[model samples]
Target: MATKTAARASVESNRNDDDEPESIPAPGAKRHHFLDPRRATGRLFVATAVGIVATCFAPVHLDWRIRAVLGWDTGALCLLVLAWNILVRSCPNETQRRAGAEDPGRNLIWAVTVLASLFSLFAAVFVLRKVRAWTGFEGQLWTGLALLAVVLSWLVTHTLYTFRYAHLYYRGGRADGLDFPKDQKPADIDFAYFAFTIGMCFQVSDVVVSCTRVRRAVLVHSLISFVYNTTILSLALNVAFNLLGDG
Candidate 1:
């Protein structure tokens, strides 16, 4: 009977060591989730920018038709990204694993995202021609500029996700080590993260503007961007905390 009991204990120990993907942590283990600015904006920027391009380039007779086919009207894709950030929240062990090896692949993701943001910004400018011709608004040029910047607003929503990813995955991890002190004069983190922050700001602003234009309503856009902008501000504060914590 004692032998059987010992065997059972050993089996349970081994089983506990195996990784259970998508499973919640066992009882008594605490998990921490932080607000990430990057994540909040990531989905908003990527999806909105992509949606705009589709709207401009699709063979459909009208831009609205393209939006219909892409299902871009409801911001479904951005919402999925927001959900993904929640799902990928890390436990302590997973956080440690992220610190062990750098994922170079993320560099490509950042680069592509940055370029896409720029292209969308320019495209918004190019579309000014149409807005001026179509609308008798008093300030057509200014409105076009503002609308061009809406994707940045939309992207701002996910900056929380991005910054949280940085906190959990990069704080004392690989990129954290490369980052400059946030407190020091002209201080900064890794170039990739730095670029990511700047790009996200623009991306988010673009989204906010774009969505507001699409809905022609401020209540939803304002409420959402308000949440996202708060995250972006928090991310700035976190960069300082991360630097201090690492020290």
Candidate 2:
């Protein structure tokens, strides 16, 4: 009877082990359906496309207030989607955690990054063209709004990069690469701090990066920020010249 009980226990343990899911789910397996990263990326992409079209082709005579409202709403929506992607959808499905190379949403995020960069580029061009034809108080208001829009676009791009960094860190089991304070695993907000510091200062502030991929990401982010800041500076000079001419 004792031997039989021992055999039964062994069989139960084996059954439990067999019931456990894999550390990485195979491709095409059903995973988390809530706030799926792919779906979120698609939403952000469509919203950005709409914003770009509106900024480029909207009626030239549209009221400034209406344009401001639309721009603000669009910027806010893009930001919201990105934040959601970072907070809720940043992690891979349970089974994919060990399959580090199979991160499902990275490519989509890259597409968003490219499109976001275009949005800011178009915004800068729009401001440059629109400023040339207007002067005085109306000119100042348009210039201010245009600058704000460009800044907003820059913010969106950096925020997306923040999410990208977070995805990379966590996908690697939060093990190496970035060394956070107290040797703790970094969270989404920590990644934001890291990414924005690069955007603002064009260099890493406190965190130490030992991973090659993260360093590459930081390099790309800094380059983009530098370009964006230079564009804003040029816009400022253009606005100053236009206003002086009006005076």
Compared with the true structure, what per-residue lDDT tens digits does model 1 show for residues 1-247?
Answer: 9999999999886554332212232333233332232233344466656667755665565455223334342343454455345435644344334322222233433543344344434434434334334444424433333343435434433343333333322332322222244422111122223334433343322222222121222233234345444643344344335434444
Cα lDDT, model 2, residue 83: 59
| Candidate 2 Cα errors over 4 Å, as ranges | 1-77, 80-106, 135-141, 172-174, 244-247
Question: Each model's TM-score?
Answer: 0.33, 0.63
- Off-target runs (Cα >4 Å) in candidate 1 are 1-59, 63-80, 87-106, 136-247
- Taken over the whole model, the C-alpha lDDT of each candidate is 0.38, 0.61
lDDT of 2: 0.61
